[model samples]
Target: MKNKSIQIQEKHHKDLQKLSESLGQSYGKLVEKMILYFKRTGIDPDDLKNESPSHKIQQLDKRLVSFLKVQERDILKPLRQETYEYYQNYDKTLKDAKANINKNLGLLDNNSEIRANHILKELAKQRKALITLSEHLDPANKKGLKTVFQNIFKNAN
Candidate 1:
């Protein structure tokens, strides 16, 4: 048997209790998952480690929203460069469909594309984050983080 020690905040006590009951698993088991995940990967698991969903965390998330936006820009760089070359090679006859999308739909004006790109980028970003968070969390924590993201995203819409 493996026994692990974890620090849980009282602020999340209610949520922990609720989860303990809903999952029919002890809080320890839940935390175990996060621990193992972090050990295997180098991502920070504590990114989701919050005792409460306070206004401060929300504000920080607001900032992360921009960071992800920047990352999305970075992700598109290679694609954009290649597309630009292709356009140049075609003498402007062929247009980049994604650029056309940006123009015709006005998606970027509303941050929809940016948000969508962030989500797409999160797939890769979260891996490292999950691994890191795992150091402070476990499988249970990973699920909790996923749940947080789900709730945050669901509420955004």
Candidate 2:
């Protein structure tokens, strides 16, 4: 391995030495590790001079929150409203259909009751006429068959 020297402030040199000893690494190894860290993270060393790490993290958190808010406003809020309106319209349509069906059923019930009553009256009249005809045709009747036939002919005239 070849050794190299670079000029730096005394304070920075002492700080680097203290950090190296605390980390249990040689001075050269510590510097190599620091270079590798910056390279892997793709961070500009000059950018760290203006802002602390905590400040950068806070900025990222704020950006993420704003992005979420925008998504909610642009996409989720409208979707939620549309879903609510669709359900409301569906509920109204269902209620209207149910009312129409109930009204039709009521009309059908009334019409059927009236028609059944009229049919029953017609059937009763027919039954009465059949009973009268059967009694006249009966052999046991005191009025003979000849008398019944003569009466039928007279009525026809």
Candidate 3:
């Protein structure tokens, strides 16, 4: 590359020289790197001349916060609302299913009680029939049959 010169203040040149020495780089190399950095970052050198580094950082922070707020408004809020609605529907469905199950269990308990009552009624009828049959038998056989029937009824109770 051909060597070129540009006019700058003596104080700025001295400052650049001091920075170059501190960074252990040649003055020309430091200038080249600064130009490359500005191009790569898409920041104008003229704008940098007017703003301090802290001011630039503060502006970037504000822009980032604004962008995040916009994202929350556009994306996160709707998703959270949708999730809440889904959970509400799911909870309602679960409650309905639980109620149905409880109703069915109540029906089963009622049915079991009815069946148990029917069985006890049939056993009572059979015991009465056996007692009448024993009275028609001979005394010796009637006594043995009476004891057996009594034992059977006792165990059933």
Candidate 1 per-residue lDDT over residues 22-101, each given as its tens digit:
88888888667657866876557566753453776888999999998888788777788999998797865455665687
The residue-level lDDT of candidate 2 at 26 comes to 93
**TM-score ranking of the models:** 2, 3, 1
Tell me the TM-score of model 3. Answer: 0.45
Please count the clashing residue pairs in each candidate, in the order shown. Answer: 16, 0, 0
Q: Give the distance in Å from residue 77's predicted Cα in candidate 1 to where it truly belongs.
A: 24
Top candidate, metric lDDT: 3
lDDT of 2 by residue, 71-108 (tens): 99999999999999999999999999999999988878
Global Cα lDDT for candidate 3: 0.87
Cα lDDT listed for each candidate: 0.72, 0.84, 0.87
Which residue runs of candidate 3 sit more than 4 Å off their true CA positions?
Answer: 1-13, 26-58, 109-157
Can you give the lDDT of residue 27 in candidate 1? 82
> Which residue runs does candidate 2 get wrong by more than 4 Å?
38-54, 110-157
Q: Say which prediction, candidate 2 or candidate 3, comes out ahead on lDDT.
A: 3
Q: What TM-score goes with each of the models?
A: 0.24, 0.58, 0.45
